[model samples]
Target: MVVGATGTTGSRVVARLSAAGLRVKATSRHATPVDGARPVRFDWNDPSSFDNALEGTDRIYLVPPPGSPDPAAVMLPFLRQARAAGIRRAVLLSASAIPLGGPAIGQVHKALPDLVPQWAVLRPSWFMQNFSGNHVHARTIRADGTIRTATGEGRVGFVDAEDIAAVAVHALTDAQAPNTDLIITGPQAVSYGDIAAVLTEVTGHTVTHRRLTHESLRDRLAADLPIEFATMLADLDRAIAKGAEDRTTDTVQRLTGHPPRDFRAFAEREMRRPRSRPV
Candidate 1:
């Protein structure tokens, strides 16, 4: 089962699992149709919707509820139900910024071992997709050639979503479940400013990084996010600026047999992809 089936990593995971000929139960709140996978209605806010999705699949790929300051309160109970329903292996997609038992999804990470027989938590670095995909950074880059953040000059490993999905597939389908937390990152660590330079030079997009103060970034995020969640996100940026996320890991290559895509490669590939014309 893949929760948040329509999301960035979740959608990719569903496709990879389905293409591998595994039965994929893809769940979204609206139960939107996805090619090559079965669709089911599931919502984090609605606990009653959990049973059918969990019972139908032996394994699950968990993507935490977006924009929630603390997802464990909702996620843990559902996970407990999944274990009770005889589900075996589960892979959870968590952020590298959040550690096991730290906060948000971390709390769920802490309880996963006790809740399920076989499980793996994928703690991936900041996504390379943040610049190329549907994130606010992508939006601002499209709108004004600017990627704004509070992360200052701090660097991030910026792993690709596809790499994350590949690792997840192996974890879910491997003969022996990894049964531990895996920290995944790209081949190199670079700052947001470096990302902007790459896009500008290689992709022909004149992008620039705009660093904001923590409070400014928080207020900007508050325009679309709950104040509490926005504050927490801004705090993550602060942590990054302190060099907390300036590290690399070889988990992607170790697990998936290929090095994670660097920011430049990711940007160039995205720029080369054919874009859809607006209707």
Candidate 2:
């Protein structure tokens, strides 16, 4: 079973699992069909959907809800329910820089290792989907040709969402690597400047990364997003500026037995796809 199955990563995970002929159950709050798979109405805020989503499910793909004050509190019970339901293997999508117990969902990641009998936390770096998906910065860039963030000259080994989904399928259906954390990344580390260049080349427009003061960025973001959420994203940018997410890893290649895709390749593919009205 895959939670958040209509989301960027979850959608891809569902597609990949179904393509591989796995018995896939996808969860969404809305009634939408995933090709060749069952779409179950599931809401994280509502516990009533848990049993329906986990029924007869042996392996599960979990994506934690972002900005929750205590995601662990919400997920622990779900994990317990899955265990009780005889769901043996679980794969969780986590962030690369967020070490177990460090901050954010770190506590949730840390607790899962001891709680679940078989689990793997996928700590992937910044996703390449941020450029073309629902990310606000991507929308601004598509509309205004400028991407604003507090990350200054810092690099990230941005992994492609497809690569992450591919790895997730392997962890779910294949041999279970219990109680392990996979720090996944692309082939190389590149700065936001590099990302801008690739995007500009692919889109044939001047899309650049503009650095902003953390305070200024926070204030601007807080206008639309919750203040705490804005503060957390700004703080993450500060951490990026400090070189926390600057390193690259081979975990993606090691796990999937294939080289991770490049950022430029991702940009070119995204450009080829039909886009929505500007931004």
Candidate 3:
């Protein structure tokens, strides 16, 4: 079962698992049908959606709802129900910035070990998709050829969502649980400036990274997002400026037997895709 089946990573997980001939239950609030999988309506705020979604599924790929300030409060009850219903394994999509017991889905990461016999927490680095997806960074780049950040020159090993989904598939289907947290990352760590250069090279646009103070970044973000959320995002950027994400790991290669894609490769591929209507 894949909760948030239409999400960035969950959708890919559904496709990969279904292609492997595994029975997959793909759930979302809308219950939209996914290719080669069963569709079911599931909402974190609605407990009634839980029983039907978990029925007959042995394992699940869990993705916390987007914009959720605290995911554990919404997800833990469902997880408890899933455990009581005989679900054996779970793969949680968490973030590298949030440690187990830190914040957001981190609490779920800390709680999963005792809830299931077989489980894995995927603590992936910043996603490469943020450059192309419906995020503020992507929108800003598309609009004015600028990528704003409080990260200054800090670098991140931005892993692709495809790589994250591939790793999730392995974590879900492997004969034995990995029994540990996987810090998945791209082949290299690159700065926002480096990403801007890659975008410029690939798209023929003079994209640039605009470094801002944490306060400025937070205020700018607060225009469209909740103040608390904006503050949290800005805090992450502040962490980056302090060299929080300036590293790489081989976890993706070790688990999937293939080295993760680098930023240049991702940029090339993204530029080739059909462009979305400008924001």
Candidate 4:
């Protein structure tokens, strides 16, 4: 089963798993059609949705809900239900910034392994798809060729969501459980300025990165998100500025047997694809 099946990485995981000839149950808040898989409605707040989604599924790809101040509060009950339903393995999507027992999803990261017979935690760096998804950065880039952040010049090895999905599929289907936390990242680190330059070269637009104070960034995010969540996001950006995410890892290559795609490759592929109307 793939929870949050319609999500950025979850959707890809579902597709890849199905393509590999595995029976997959993909779940979302609504019954959205997923090719080559059974679609089920599942919501974190609703326990009644759990049984149907967990039926006939032994492994699960977990995507935590967004804007969750405490993900464990929303995810733990469902995970317990999954265990009772006989689900044996789980692959959890976590962030590189949140270590085991740290904060947010880290709580789940610490408990998931012991809760299930087999499990793997994926701690991925900033996603390269942020520039193409419906995120604030993507919207700003599409609307005015500008990327706004409080990250200053902090470098990050932005991992591709596709690579994340591939590694997830491996973790979900491998005969022997990895039984460890995987720090997934791209081949090299790049700053927001470097991303802007890559965007300029790929999209033929004069893309630029605008640095903002953490306070200003928080205010901007609070316009669309809760104040507390906005403040937390801004603080993450501040951490980035302090070089918290400035490193690369071989986890993706080691697990998936291929080098992780770099930001430049991602930019070129995104440019070649038909552009979608900005959200």
How far out, in Å, is residue 246 in model 2? 1.1
Off by over 4 Å in 4: 272-279
Candidate 2 has an lDDT of 0.85
Let me know the TM-score candidate 3 reaches against the reference structure. Answer: 0.96
Quantify all predictions' global Cα lDDT against the true fold. 0.90, 0.85, 0.91, 0.91
Per-residue lDDT tens digits for candidate 1, residues 1-279, read 999999998999999988989898889999987766999999999998998788768898999999888898899888889988988988999889999888788998999988889999999999888876678998999899999999999998899899999999999999999999999999988999998888888767698999999999999999999999999899999999999999999898898898888877787777753557999
Pull out the clashing pairs in model 1. none
In model 4, pairs of residues that clash are: none
Off by over 4 Å in 2: 272-279
Model 4: lowest-lDDT 10 consecutive positions: 267-276
Candidate 3: stretches off by over 4 Å:
273-279
Quote the positional error of residue 254 for candidate 2 in Å: 1.2
After superposition on all C-alphas, the RMSD of every candidate to the true structure, in Å, is: 2.8, 3.2, 3.2, 3.2
lDDT of 2 at 60: 84
Which residue pairs collide, candidate 2?
none
Worst 10 residues of 1 by lDDT: 267-276
